[model samples]
Target: MIPGVMEAAVLNKPMDIELKQVPVPGIKEDEALIRVHCIGVCGSDVHYYEHGRIGRYVVEKPIILGHELAGEVVQVGAGVTNVSVGDRVAVEPGVACGRCEYCKSGRYNLCPDVVFMATPPVDGAWAEYVAVRSDFLFQLPDGISFEQGALLEPLSVGMHAMIRGRVNPSDRLLVTGLGPIGLLAIQAAKIYGVTEIYATDIVPFRQDLAIEMGATAVINPAKEDLKERIAELTSGRGVTVIVESSGNGRAIPDALTTVNRGGRVVLVGMPAAKEIPVDINTIIDGEIDVYGLFRYANTYPSAIQALGRSDIDVERVITHKYALKDIQEAVEVARTEKETSIKVMIYPQL
Candidate 1:
């Protein structure tokens, strides 16, 4: 007995957001209708709001924006079997055509025909209800809160970076950002058995939060010599893995300087600049392997399992919450209040 219409926050243009009643989405044969409980505001969402695009994904028309979300399943189509009414779940935002080669090979994140939520031309979960493929929804464990469930999306990013970096128990890692992704990356590294982890950021609060999230040490890159500190911490050998989530142009060369020879540098952040100058000799001399990460592939189940465990506290990163009506302010705080806000969440039902 879902309503025919639901409230949604629509982005008509850059910096123009409006709340209006829109028709509830209809479920497909393999889709389920969910009543959204919580949605996390991501940097991508804010980027689209403020800049109207990210790279080439431009918003050509009115769109609903938000992707990191968790909710209760309220309706299902004929082919839906994985979730039922009242099941609390986290939504994996990317939907790939099963016939695609990337999908068949388990690399659906790179699928050419994939329709990812909030990435232009696809309406996302900033509304009261969303209809998503049943397989993309994972049931939340008994003790996991909706906020934590929504956070699985960013957690998946960190997990994907960890996998790409091939982080191990013996690896000493450097995470160059204190954003939500950086904080989650530190936690992911700890979960992967890396005992020595270092994090650097321009913001002190975020640096402190990183320490709380299990970093062995935190550095302020604006005031401190990051490469020298890493040298001191690693006893002049440098770290084995550098997880660059900041997308800062300067961080790239710093990573090349601080990473151990033959080590890996995983780039998770999307840089604003289209092209960055790189010293080919530096990369060649160290034989540093660089890896690029897009949104995660095949990580939803592992993210859910990690959330079910008690050791990792995903909720700690959340610093602010707002009702759907306050989405404008929410996005502003997330964009302007970086030092004080790590993760901002929205409650559509509120």
Candidate 2:
């Protein structure tokens, strides 16, 4: 028996997340009603909570703000057949219009009509009950916890960046920024057979965590010369692949300098500055291939498979947990405590 109302953490505006009682969302014929179990606190979620916007997306009205989520199917619409009630699943928050050219070309993440969850106007999975399109939900194996299922979203981002960078066994990779995405990139690189992996971050905890997660070497950019360290690691040849997840203005140019000639640099981070000056000369002279990632496409299955394996312990990244009622505190800790926290998770059911 679905209740008429459910509890949710609603952002009335920036820094104003309220635990309110809202009507359970109704599902369309192709959608299912999920009882949200765990939701990961993404950097974008914190940005929106603190700043009320990210680039063009703004909180024009009240919205629920969480995208990385996992839940159990409580009910299904008449037309839903892929999953039934009681299925544990991870919800891919982006619902794309299948008719778009990007969708037809198998790059639905680029679909112009994508209604991404937690992106303004699209309510996300912060509530107790969320209506997700059946196609966007992936079943979780029994062994995978809800927390790990929620984390698959960020893992997918790392996987996508690695794919865009064309990571291979022979490639020496450099991952800038040891945020959740950067850490996951290290795991993804290892899975892809990249033996030599280097990571950099300003946070000592993150740098140490990166090393624990199989990074060959970790550098503290604030204290050390990053370019010199990369040069020393690569014997002055520079890394073959660079995954720039920091979005730090300085990291961008440094990556260009540290990447080998004809190397690939994949930009995964959303930079704080809209227009940072780039070294166009280096890009042109080195013939470097640069790729920009927007969310992810066709990566959930791979991410889930990777998590199923024992080699990569994705759960280790979770450093904090909070109930839905304390969402504001969770967001605050995630925003202020970067050095100590890797990932903060919210248990909506609690």
Candidate 3:
């Protein structure tokens, strides 16, 4: 018997995501049919809707608009075994080619042949049910909410950033953004034992939220001089590590200026323009370590481990929630980049 078709929010064009009835996605022999419960609205999804492009991936056809997902396994394929029906799970969206050199090097996130959800023509889990490979689904413990499960996708990036920075106890860490990613990085750094965390943001609410997230100090660059504040905070020596999550061109220069000699800087944000005037001379003179991120790898397990600990309450960063019916508004809210809105999620069933 044929299954029921469900309504999926498809990207029709720029500023347009229409609800279309798509056939229920089929499951492979090693796949499972999942009923999506929560899907986080990613920044890339908003970019694709507003500009119809993200880097070189052009939206030539209508595509679904979600990737960060938590769902229930409704049906398991004949060969599936990792998860059973009724298991709540978090879906890791990327399916990488195992034979790639990057994959063999344990850095599969850099795989050029990876097919990520919500990127261009790839349809994501923005509908009632999706067929996904069982290996990509991580079982959700009863103690964890589906929403938190959805958040792992982003939180893992933050965790990976901290790991990439090799954050140590009592290290002065400078985080130069207060978006959801930035906030999570704060929490990740806190858990990793960064003694004094300093945050910078133009948004007042974001700066306040940063303090709440365990920043020792919050600086508003719009109101304060970044270099002066860093110098004052560190007594002119500078921080040990910096995480540049703002994607603002100015933030890179400030990050370089704020770091101590031989400090590490990790860039997680994408700029409006890919080119940023990073003072290479300052980096060279300071002997700074700079790292670039492309999503994450081997970090989800740590994110799940953190969620189970109960020491860090990450859901506080969720400022708004939307149902599938309100997805258009959800994307629009994300685009506004308002201080009141940090991270937004779309619950298709709600």
lDDT of 2 by residue, 137-247 (tens): 999998999988998899889989988888899999999999999999998898788889999988878988998899999988889898799889888777999999998
TM for every model, in the order presented, reads 0.98, 0.98, 0.96
lDDT score of residue 301 within candidate 2: 84
List the lowest-lDDT window of 10 residues for candidate 3: 1-10
Clashing pairs in 2: none
Give per-residue CA lDDT, model 3, range 1-350, as digits (tens).
33689878988999988878889888889899999999888888888999999888999988897899999999999999899999999998988887889999988889999888888778887788888888788998879999989998888888889988888886899988888899989988877878788998988889888888789899888999887898898888678999999888878777887788899999888878766677788889889999888888877767887787766778878888988888888888989967689889888888
User: Model-by-model lDDT, in order?
Assistant: 0.91, 0.91, 0.86
Clashing pairs in 1: none
Candidate 1, residues 1-350, lDDT tens digits: the string is 89999999999999998898999999899999999999999999999999999987999999999999999999999999899999999999999997888999998999999999999989988999999999999999899899889999999999999999999998999999889999999878877889999999988889888888889999888898888888888788779999999988878877876788899999987777878887778789989899999999988787777776667888889999999999999999999998799999999999
Q: What lDDT does candidate 3 reach at residue 12?
A: 93
Off by over 4 Å in 3: 1-3, 235-237
Q: By how many angstroms RMSD does model 1 differ from the true structure?
A: 1.0
